[model samples]
Every structure is written in C-alpha cells, then in structure tokens.
Target chain A: MTLALRVEHLRKSYGAVAALDDVSFEVERGEVFALLGPNGAGKTTSIEILEGFIARDAGSVEVLGIDPGDRQHLRGLRDRIGVVLQELAVESFFTVRQVLERNAGFYPHPRDVEEVIDMVGLSEKSDAKVKRLSGGQQRRLDIGLGIVGNPELLFLDEPTTGLDPAARRTTWDLIRHLAAEGTTVLMSSHYMNEIEALAQRVAVLSHGRVAALGATATLGGRDRSEATIRFTLPSGVAASDLPITPWRVEGDTVEVRSDDELRALHALTSWALEGHIAVTGLSVARETLEDIYLALTRGDRAEIDEEPDDTKARTP
Target chain B: MSTDVRPAPQRSRFSDLRLVAHQVKYEQLAFWLNRVGAVFTVGFSVVFLVMLGASAGSQKVQSLGDISLVSYYVPGFIAYGVMAAGFTTLSVTLVVRRETGLLKRLRLSPVPTWVLISSILISTAIITLVQALLLVVIGRYGYHVAFPSSWLALLVAVIVGILGFAAMGVAISAVVPNQESAGPVTSIVFFVLLFLAGLWFPLPPNSGLAKFSNYLPVRHLIIAMDHAFGVPRGATPWAWHDLLVVALWGAGATLVSLRRFRWAPRRV
Candidate 1:
C-alpha cells in the first residue's frame, strides 16, 4: 500500500565499468518484486546499495523511508531490512540456534528464535553444528538468520541458486509465506520459472540498465504478443488447402503464428473438419517468459539467459 | 540532519553493552565448539609449556641473574599464548570469515561495527587470558616455578599484549588474499616474529637478535611479560617502555586495518 523503498537515477561505477547506470525502481510495502538478470547484470550491486552495504555514485536512494546513503540513518534502516547473500554466512562451528540467537540480539524487535527455526524447516537441526547440516539445510538456516530479526523488508540475492529442486520449492513457499505475511521481498534470480512463480512484478536488468519493467506475466508485453500454433500436417494433405497459410513448414509440420489465435484456431479446425482430417500435435502457446526475457535483454546469451544448466557466467 | 536522529536498535548504553556480550558468548561458543580451532589457539600454549618445563628442569639462565630456565620458559610461553590467540589465531579467523562472506553478513546486520569488532577482540582476549592462566598454573604446580610477583603487573601486560596483537591481527587479515592461504600467511609471519622475539630461548639483553627484535612488538610484549614475572629476579615488575613500543605498533597496525579492511569477499 505504501512505498517500502525507492531509487531515483541510481548510478554506480567500478573503475571503467558502470555497474549500475541510472537504475530506478520502487518496491511496495508488501509486494514480492524481482530483479531478473544474469551474473554481472547489477542485481547484487543494487541490492547491496539499498542495504547500505555500499554507496551509490549518484542517486537518491531511500529504504524504509530513510536514506541509505546517510551514514547516521543506516543502522536504523538495517534494523528494518534483512539480507540473504549468495554465500551462506553462517559460521561452521556455531549451532543453528546459537547463530540465530546471536543475530537476534542485534535487532530491537527480534522474532522468536525457535519459531524462526521451525519456519525455515530446521527445527530438528537447531542444536546441530552448521557444518553438519546439508547444503539445503544450511541454506534454510541462512534464510532463518535473515528473518530472525523480523525485518520489514527482505533482500534475497540468488536465494535458491545452488539449491536442489525440493529445496528450491520449499524456499519459494517460504518466500511467498513471508510476503503474504506483509514482508516486502526484493529478490534476484536467474530462473524464469522462479520469477513467474513468486514475483508479482519484475525489473529485467541488462548491461546495468533496466531493459524492461512490468508485471511478471506481462513483461515486455509478452501477454499481448502473438502466440505460435503448431500442428503436424496430415499425410498427403497440401498446405495450401488450409483456410490460412502456414507461417513456416518444416518437413510435415506446419507452424502458424497470429495475434488472433482464436480466429486462427477456428479456421484450422474448420478446414480439418471439412476434409475429415485429424489435426494431431496441435497446440497454441503464448511467448514464454524466457523468450521475452532474452528479447528484452537483446539476446544476452540465450544459453545463460534461459538454461540454468549451462552459460555459467553473464558478462556485464 | 534533523532526520538523522534515527531509531537505534538498542537505545540504552546498557542494552548495547548486552548486545556485545551476546555476540561474544556465541563467538566463544564458536571457538570452543570447534575442536581444531580450540586446540590450535589454546592447547598449543598448554602443550608447549608442559613440554618445555619437563625438559628445562633446573637449568639456570645467567643472562642477568640466576633465574631458572623453567621460570623463564613460563613467561615466554605465556607471551606466546597472548600472541597466538590475539595475533595468529585472530588474523586467520578474520581472513576466513571475510573470504567466506561472514564479515559482509555482519556488516549488513543491525549491529554496529564497534559491537562486532569489540566482541571479536574481547573473544580473543578471553582466549589469551585462559591460555595465560593455564600456562601459569602449569608452571607453578607442574614445574614448581614461582608465579608472577605482581599479578596486577602481569594482568596489565597481558591486556596490553592482547590489544596490540589484536590490532596487528586485523591488519594482517586485511592483506591475506583468501581462506586457503590464511593459515600459511599468518603462521609464517607469526613464527618468524616469535623466533626473532626469543620464544625458543631467552635472548641475552644486548644480543643481535634482541637488538633487531627490539623494534618489533613481539619482543616488547615478551620483555613486558618477563618484567611482570620478574624473570631476571628482583627487577621492577613494570615495563612501561616496552609496553609503549607494543602500543605504538598496535596503533600503527590499527591505521593499516582502517586503510585496508574490507567486509565483502575479495573474489566477488
């Protein structure tokens, strides 16, 4: 309902490389917003600047209604914000409960340490040394640390990057639960499904610039984009006999792309009915979020942009 | 500037002090729970004292007066304990913490830098104090060596050494590039300093090793501990001049730490 954080013309440079160039976005008090970008796309840099961990070169940045750039106000702002970095920062020797309790002491109003343990699904491992926990469990404990303070705003930079499928699903549920409980969540991820599953709105960053910003489904007008309809041609049928000509045909398959998918589908099915032909392998699908993301970023490594299995690093 | 007066996490001074105590409790837990870290930080001094005491027996060091070799060994190992805890162990731990992103996490938390720093320093002081006490007990009971004549003087020297070495610890941690090299870098620097400071054997007052190490804090801390223990027999149990030199090195190291300290991981 209210602005939790706002940035205006945010700019930062690392020597010759501009890490963030005129970045601007606003996060509402209870919205789950996402910054979708690759490795060097300035997502982490933006999060760090907002967390008061680093200063912006030139920008009017405000977090929780306080200027993060002002040194005197940073502590109070930190009290209201939670950060989960890419690295699991829990010490190897301290037990889960011990680390949580220690960090809890830093905040004026800390959540119940036991409740945080349960919330992160680490109740059974509270007394276990951090080094003993599995990677997923450790990642859960790391999230537990972030929320132990009951912060108003949560910053999660690649929260589930190295997590397995089950762990990632649990993490997504936990993030949703937090956001539903009125915690403004700002997150960055390389996974499109993750953004689609969680974020209500997203800002796609590329080369340190906001290439696209809108609701997740409608990003880059993807919802309004033309849908592709594909159907394998019936044996001995001519492509020209159809009411609408195919956009492209490869071998026996016919591809049809149109903004009026309903009209096109009707025409193709009507022709099939008249010819007593079965329209097998027929499907109509909108532009996938990954496809739109790549298009918006100007094809910033399609391999890195979409596939999590490959394209390891993304250049700035 | 008016809006700068923000809501503090813990408003009262008493509560802020409690916050540091809270962090220190976990720090101690972290150190002691790790068997290897505890052994390396505190056990080393205990093991060294017992071994050296058994071998030195009744041998006398006639450098200034006939102080038995075991008595000299006690103060020397005690100083070594302080440096090991505050300098070597602290530096390596810090580098690992920084490289692992622990420091960045702490920086992002609501806790002030002062609280985080003081908690670690206090934790280091506690480790050193425990070692010093353990060594003193071993010397007094196991080897029949007399305790420091002035316990207050020894406490002052121990505190000074802790502060000085802790500063140098932060300074050295800043130079260490990564976690893999943290141990080797700190140990190599520490062992060389220890050798020059005469930990293996007491340096004769004006020996070349003594003259050279005089400019380093390790030797000054050793001399201060020696005076507190009255190693040369009936000497003043205060070494203000030596403590001053150690304090100066600490101040210089403090400047280096201020200039070079970074919270974020270097590789990132």
Candidate 2:
C-alpha cells in the first residue's frame, strides 16, 4: 500500500527540551492511524510538524510526497489535507452554512457544501449562527469545515475532547465513513476507547518518543497479556475448594490469573458443577489498551529528568 | 479503490485575488451581524459629528476661508472615522481573532497568508468608505457643510488614509499581548493619536504644538481632507506635504506590521 505520510527520525526541540525525540512512523493511505499519549507526550508538536504549522529541528518528513519544510509546496499540500484544530476555531458571527461555504472556497476541488453539512449532521443548524449553536453542534461545524475541501488526507487533533458520549460516537462514525471512502485520517487523542473504536493502528508516544507502535489489538503485546478470571462462589464455598492451582479470594468471590482462559474457564465450570456450587458473575478479561499505555509510559519520568534544563524549559 | 485523483492545481495570482474577494464578502457579512460592534464603529463618528456641529456649527475659522466650525470639523472627523475603522477596529478584531485561534485556523486553509491579511484590510476599507459617505451626508443636510471641492483628491486621501491606518492596526495588534489587553492598548493609542491629529480642535497655524502636529500622520490626514474639501490651509488648494507625510507613515507602519505579524499566538 502507498504511504500517505512518513517521518524518519523526526526531532524537534523547544529550547533545550526535545518535544519530538527521534520519532518515526508511517501511515498508509486510507488507513486510520491514532497518535495516543498523555498531555505532555508531544502529540501536538509531532502533528504540527507534519502539518507544516511548525518546523522540525531535525527530521525527514513527507506528506503526500511533499516535504512539509518546503514553504513553496505548502499551499499545494494544504489543498489536499484537511485539519480540525484542537480548539473551537470558527468565526462566531457566521452562520453554519456561511462558514462551510467560506472554507470550501479555499480548495480547488471542494466537496458540495450541502453534502459536507449533511455528512457532519449539521443540516438542521445550517442557518443558525455559529455562536448560537450548542458546543456539540459547533464541534460538528468544525468538522464540516475540515471535510468541505474534499481532501485526500485529514488530520484531527483531539477531535472529541469535550464532546458528550453520543456526540463522540457520531464523530467516530463520521471518521469511519471517511476512511471507508479512501480518506486517510491521522488522529491524535488521549481517549483510548476512541482509539480502540476507530483506529486500525496506533502509536503510543511517551516523553517525546514512540514507546509502542502497532495494530490496535496487538499494541505493546496486549493480545499476549494474561487473562484475568473472576467469579463469585456460592454461599458456604471456600477458596480452598476450587480446583485452580493459584487463586485469590475476597469475600465469596475468587479471582484467578490464567494464561489459557478457555481451558481455565472450562476447568472451573466443571469443578463448580461437581461441587454443587454456582459460579456467579463469571468474567474473563485481559489487559486493555489503557493498561498497556500506562505500563509503557510509567517508567519515563527519569528520562525527563535526564534532559538538560534548556530542553526542559521547552517541554510545555 | 481508485487512485486516479489529480494533484491540486498550482495556485495563480488570480486565485489569490478571488480568495480575497470571497473573504472580504464574508467578513462584511460577519461585521453586519455583529450589530453592537458595528454600531459602535460607525456610531462613534456620527456622534462626534453631531456634537461638534451643534456646538460650533456657525463659528468661522480663518484658515478654512471663513468656513463654519462645522465645516472645519467635518474633514477632521472624516479622518477620525477612517482611523477608527482602519486602525482601532482592525487592531482589536485581529487580536481577538488571533486569541480565538481564528487566524491559526485560517493558516491551515489553502488561503495564502497575504490573502487573509489583505481581505481584512479590504473589509475595513469598505466600512470606512461607508462611514465617510454617511458623515458627508449628515454634514451636508444636518449642518450645511459644503460638498468636497475636488472629488478625486478626496478619494485619493481617503484611500491613502485607510490603507495606512489599516497597516498600522495590524502592527499594533502584534504588540498587544492578549485579548484582554487589546482594548486598552488600542484605545489608548487611538485617543492619543486622535488628540495629536487635532480632531476636537485645530491647532493654531505655525504654533509649537501645531508644527509638531504637522509631523503626525493623523494631522496630515485631517489637513489633506480639509484641502480636498476646498478649505485651503493657506496659499495652496491642496496639501501635498500633508499627503506625503500621511503616505510615508502608512508605508512605514505597513513595513513594521509585515515584519512583526504573527498568525499564531505568541509564546512567552
């Protein structure tokens, strides 16, 4: 597959602190790629470098086969890329339709304004002024502006930071629909569930470095983590009665860590049946993306301290 | 999936012009919808015209060929109106837009940075023209101020004043640190310059203060407007010196603004 974006050894320092430290990744065309990290993980810095908003200190970066550092190429590159900034960026006095039409004029081959409005689910509020729209509606308008240009690539920086659950789900559907239509999307978000629901691949950044990068299901060996099995035992059943070799008991509940969840579940169910004891609330779970993310980022505090003071000053 | 999509065409200067036209149209629409700010922008000029005309309409000033005080103040207030729209209003709006991330958002669009800046300047020019026309109408009917003696010179002076002041506004916005400070900084700069321009009252010819005022852009703007309206300052029917001074200030301010302009918020 063709790559939509590629960054090799991207390095950016704000004074002495390295905001993006030798980061490298490639996003395939028509794929949904997520940059997952905490608040100071340099997500914004990395994305901005790719977007041509900020220059990188040292790196080889390409978007749509154009170097972002090439000022002359920026106008052409911008025509093919759509960006939904992290902030609510719209003229408050303009109506929704006006805002869409204005932004649509910036590109050579813009999507129909009405179609973009409908795609973002802002049709009903099309005539309402931007200031009058609810926070969620305004956010939809922001998305509407981003897609109005019919861009081949879209960059969404924390697309659903403050959105309610329902609104966030709608945005997720919108992103999925776009990717399905062959629009490559690069999204940065701290919400792990959002990454799980939409991203085909994810790169977790910690302390300005890619701590882990892979397909969402397999990131940081998540698929290989031990499964956790928990069940509540029937009254008068003691933990010692369980056939499992290693188990912990709390109240009437028993927990067991199992490498093979299917076999462990089968053995426990059979034991319960033989002992005439019921296993209530039985569940088998494994480490989630959030768990893996925490594990990857948890040990980077010392690296932060090792940086020179001038580099540290640029962290924020 | 088909990968036959063509690359975006190289942008021509004509496209940049078209973008500016489009942006100016929407900016005008936005300004119109902001009724309160719009009212204040234009209303301040009207209020000053009425107050000054009512109080000193009949008083004759010798430098203006014995024209009524209302006539003298007409050109002065016109200069004031252009400055308000171009310098004060533009600065405040630009600062607010920058603070709200509107400029940064625009930067992400295919619109060139120059196009964005030019569109705003053009919008302010349009508004200043409207204010000038309205002030003339109010002066003609309400206070009997004469029509401009030379329409062409009046047009040139107004254009020069608008462009110059608009550039100055953009420069001022760069110095302004944040939105909260935008108002106070612009207002203080505006009123101080207005005073130096002799809007409330004309300074005596060849006096120390008036000689100093001759070097200021606002004073030159007001004097040029007076000469264009057939109110000769002395021997000449036009104020070439004043026009040159105003143009130089405009050019200087524009240079400063272009050098210092920032699309994104400044980092501490």
Highest DockQ among the candidates is held by which one?
A: 1
Give a tens-digit lDDT track for model 2, residues B193-251: 78876788867778887878777788888988888887753434477888888888888
User: Candidate 2's residue-wise lDDT over A1-316, tens digit each?
Assistant: 6889999999988666777899999999888999998776788788888888877889799998999888889888999999998888888888899999989988999999999999999888899989998888888889888899898899999999999999898999999999999999999998999999999999999989999999999997879989989888667766776778556778766789988889988898898888778679988889999999999888655333332212100101
- The numbered model that scores best in lDDT is 1
True contacts kept of 2: 0.45
Most accurate candidate by TM-score? 1
Reference-based lDDT, residue B122, model 1: 90
Task: For candidate 2, give the docking quality class from DockQ.
Answer: acceptable
| Angstrom error at residue B186, model 1 | 0.8
Q: Give candidate 2 misplaced runs (Cα > 4 Å).
A: A230-255, A265-283, A299-316, B7-11, B62-65, B204-216, B232-237, B266-268
Q: Chain B alone: TM-score in each candidate?
A: 0.95, 0.91
TM-score each candidate. 0.92, 0.89
